[model samples]
Target: MLIGAEAVDTAVELNAYLARFGYGQGLSIQQLWAEMDRVWAEMGLDNRRPLGSQRIADFYAHPVWVLNGLFADTDPTSVRHRQAIAAFLKDACDDQARLRIADYGGGSGALARQIVDRLPGRSQIDLIEPFPSDFFRRRLGYRSEIRFHDVLSSDGYDVVIAQDVLEHVEQPIALAQRCIDATRQGGLVLFANCFYPCIQCHLPGTFYLRHTFRYVLASPALSYVGAVPGAAHVLIFRKHGEIDVAALVRRDRIARGVGPLLNLLGQFHSQMKTLGRRAGLSE
Candidate 1:
């Protein structure tokens, strides 16, 4: 929603603010919270009406504000986040001279910057973010290897990264399919922050937690690589071939039917694990 010189100025100010915190140095939770508060105050949002009062669509429609509020600092997760994707690309592109990568819902260009900075060889990166910031647009002007798109296309990228995005969408399954379709055979798809209970425009449901991975694994197009589970889970999948639409639909329906039960069991398991850890019964 920010326009003209004000947007540009805010963008510059935000960059400087983040820099002071050692942007990629893996900030502690306390440091992250303090910096987030500082950034919110700097944006003059500290006194503004709470976002809950506004329609979720309108609140998120302001890409600049949403990104600034949620991601002012790259937290400790970023190091492992970047490394996972980088490792996948390195293996996938073995013996190849160049790679094509896409970041679906990549906000503020943080992950893209990390990939380009750490990875070697010539790579063409495309960011498919519907609501990218003015800062990101400006950065695109300077970075020749990266381009921005308002929508996903049949670009057939070698690697597609979608982090902290699925939980916010209305139709996560369809979006997941789109991400899979946009990837080439043997390409990697990195998904993180999938549906879990949290705040800010997250659709109400635990169906995704129970069945999304099952659906992904059932699809003939994809192969499960691994998962890193925590407060926010990270799932990795590899595209093998074209999707089996009929099979996917069938699996989705089945998942929906049994998802609630699975969700309950999953919650119970998580609670038990937490209890065990507290009781010093877990290694």
Candidate 2:
């Protein structure tokens, strides 16, 4: 029943965890955030360029991802996003119980907990995080309903969620396919990606999806279901079957061919929005 401020305070939890186990005993949460950034730089992860797949995997597998999730998952905006997704699920799966849900790269299991509270089901949540935080593991250890997985099966999930995951990968297309493949036919799949150059971890290579998400819409295996109403970033779809890989590849090729112009336009729009905010004309 906890919501808003009464919900888990990830900052406080992270601070305490760092003080107890990490090399951050005397540091504030802000300092820890900065230290994480510094460590990333020292590890050569913040090169601000497109990293290869192996490098991206190695970066994510490092223990720093634990800190990164703790720092990133509980802002006001992220809290509201979890609430919206929970509400959406409550309505979307009202008639169903015993749901099998998969959360792809779900970091700290906050959203999974929210969904469990709202859904009137004995659902099993498979948290597909390769590098799950120790905090998350210990906190949810007693909750058998929420299972952890380094990798997941290719199918049988009633719902598959990949919030804020696609942009961090080197091969987003392959990742997207896995998400789609993981869902059973007629099952739901939700994706929220920030394919912009917003942070060091969000790979620049994945920005191709910034303006080319229509390619996903055109897939034969999936039917576009609707955007999460309050959280426009989260899009829902239903998988029909396996994708027509050849057709999808051809469409993707065409999309990539036009990606440069689309990227330029997207950058121009962002610049204008920034300018408007600076001029006190927009928020």
Candidate 3:
């Protein structure tokens, strides 16, 4: 549904509106909105009630999980968020692949709900969420399909996704391994959780990175935060345990294209930060 002239204009206005906090800087809002209008109308999208720069940009950019944990003060599924996600997924995963995806531990299936509108029509995406939203479940999987499970096992899936679900488990690595056990070989487990460095000790229970512009300004790292060092996104490939994600990232080169060249260097900063924490914790 997100195609042609309307989407282009909506995307442009969104990019410009999101840029005010500094990160979305210098993007041509007027030109972009003009380009994306057809996209906006086709998608039945509108930006209702303007939001703060940080919240507008953050929720628009990050996965819904990170947006929830980090910006607890704001609504996770804001209109701006919807528009941004629609625009972004169009660029990233607009392929004609029939994906048997699992939204493992997804609450209310909002992620799955949004995907229905954004992805190409009849993509055969199955969203498995143990806790499906009564409201959202009804809406999800119309164009696609969303299967709700009170409990779920990952078997019989092409791509298993657990966004911020891993941190809550005591044995996160074990949980990740279990997710791997569920995924069909060559299927992916898409994880987009927060990263807490080694220097930052675990405070008990589950905690995730709640990075803000102020937080980024104060800290020294510059990458999408992963799980804490002792805790990271533990993915098990069909054959191998780890995917060469960095090289994979290089293949896409989006980080390289977006900002300063040096900004790309910090993607691995969390790994190093974890090592540093391990040294100190061991000492």
Strongest candidate by TM-score: 2
State model 3's lDDT. 0.43
RMSD to true structure for each model, in Å:
6.0, 7.1, 17.3
What CA RMSD would candidate 3 show?
17.3
Per-residue lDDT of candidate 2, residues 191-258 (tens digit): 99888755567677667678787564577678888899889999999999888877877766777677
lDDT of 3 by residue, 75-151 (tens): 33333443453344444444636556666666555556556666645334455544344334544445346677655
lDDT of each: 0.66, 0.76, 0.43
- Poorly placed runs, candidate 2 (over 4 Å): 1-36, 46-58, 61-64, 273-283
lDDT of 1 by residue, 220-275 (tens): 66888776433135677888999887787777667767777777888899999999
Runs in model 3 deviating more than 4 A are: 1-96, 139-144, 195-283
* Per-prediction TM-score: 0.74, 0.80, 0.40
Global fold similarity of model 2 (TM-score) = 0.80
